[model samples]
Target: MARRGVWELEKITLYYCLQGGSSQGTRGFVEERLASFAKENPQIQFETVIEEGHPEAVGLYRNGYKRTLSLRNLEPIEVHDHLLYLRNTWGEPEQKHSKISYGVISNTPSVQGYWRTEPDLEAPSSVRRSYLGQIPPNVPPQFRSFAQLQRELGLAGVTELLQNLGCSKWVVSGMTGVKVKSRKKRD
Candidate 1:
């Protein structure tokens, strides 16, 4: 099978913008920092842009996502760090996510013994249940759980059943009824 991937440019493009009317020193400072960084890593491509009113350093990734950070009044050290940060990124903003210590490795081999097709240890009879302990033991062969009733009733069946019972009262619950709870009475 062919590998699925994005059409990314082999070289990174550091696209920056400084206001045309700004001090010449600002442009000089930015260019100096960029030049130093470019010299440090020769693989990156620098594309400088001077938009008259816009003033920010933008990291234009091969993937087309641009990260723009203001460098208007910042010192050279800060700008240098920002440039380093932008250059090191995968072209996306810091995503909102939790720090996960363990991850699922789908391709891990079973020889490691961590990956298994079946249960490694048999759970105690008291701890384990057949059919998730859902099916009633006394249920006859032909009978099934109230699966259809749950579908027809929907949630606790309060709203729909209330309508069926000719009760005009409105029941306030969330949009999805799978997380059904009894209506709490107000004081």
Candidate 2:
């Protein structure tokens, strides 16, 4: 998707009503102009349906996404413009963007300047070694299991235990975390 290649509308389903305000005129214009346009583009297939509703153009792409443009009360030139728009575009939703800058390669950290290509050039820790956030490691007095932590503190103790372990999605508490809830209160 980064480097877009030549893309043409795979299929054009022109739907128009048999008896309507502008449907008849739109259908006539399509038969005369748009039908031949599709023929010129061999990769594009055209089909006209006499539906019971208003005139509309439904474009089908190879990626299985469909786009529809209502051709209500429009002239042949206007309909042609809309058709060209659909044919050229990928048929995706439009979003407003002020400016687009190069995105940092995902693995490369884009936030704080903590990343370095050479590991040896890294800075040493700025905090104390005692509670330097070394977690899941045996913190002498800290509870390692959720049940043990709950017994001493309470349910909120289990939450704090998880928070201490970096609170990342990859970090998860085991069944001990849930089974602790079912235990009767200690009198």
Candidate 3:
């Protein structure tokens, strides 16, 4: 997108209906601002076509690529911005974008452990902490670990108790690795 130059755009055509309500802003833009814009961008040919439809701005590139943008109900400034955007574009079809995860990327091994929102699912039950730091006095000794509390009350009940105790999401998330030991043993 950075490499796209305005010089690549050979022509810009603004289509509008002379009497349509949706084309009112475009009409005003053509009448008041388009002349100056054309004068400023002397390299590109600016043409205004009066048609019976909603207003639209189209850009034709030197590579035979074309891009169109709806100008319906847009103010003169907005129309100018759209034109500027069109001038800078390569007229390529839109592509799907992946979600960007913000985290430290390093070639070397991290001195401190990497940050995690959720616990390691593959870790053994004994390896995972039942709670974050020390347990508070309000919590009973019988329910020393979050796993013990979860077994007696179930997940929903445990969540309610945590909420009532004013535990934040971070606190609960920290204890997600807490898995209770099952009575059945593998041979």
lDDT of 3: 0.74
Across 1-187, the per-residue lDDT of candidate 2 in tens digits comes to 1116646468888888878987866776776797677766777787888878889999888778898999988787888887788788775667555458443447766566655575432124452122222344543343345435544665355456655654533222332122222223458
RMSD in Å for candidate 3, one decimal?
A: 13.0
Error of 2 at 131 (Å): 32
lDDT of 1 by residue, 12-106 (tens): 33333454543243466556766677787665666666555535666666667877776665556776776667666676567665677445546
Best by TM-score: 3
Candidate 3 Cα errors over 4 Å, as ranges: 1-6, 100-187
lDDT of 3 by residue, 1-187 (tens): 2343447788999999989999988988998999999898888899899999999999998778899999999988899999999887775766656577555557898787777797543334443344444556665554466656665775567767766665545234453343323233359
Per-model CA lDDT versus the true structure:
0.52, 0.63, 0.74
Worst 10 residues of 3 by lDDT: 175-184
Q: How close is candidate 3 to the true structure, as a TM-score?
A: 0.51
Clashes of each: 0, 0, 0
Pick by TM-score: 2 or 3, better one: 3
RMSD of each: 16.9, 15.4, 13.0
Better of 1 and 2 by TM-score: 2
The lDDT leader among the candidates is 3
Worst ten in a row by lDDT for model 1: 171-180
Q: Which ten residues in a row have the lowest lDDT in candidate 2?
A: 170-179
What overall lDDT, based on C-alpha atoms, would model 1 receive against the true structure?
Answer: 0.52
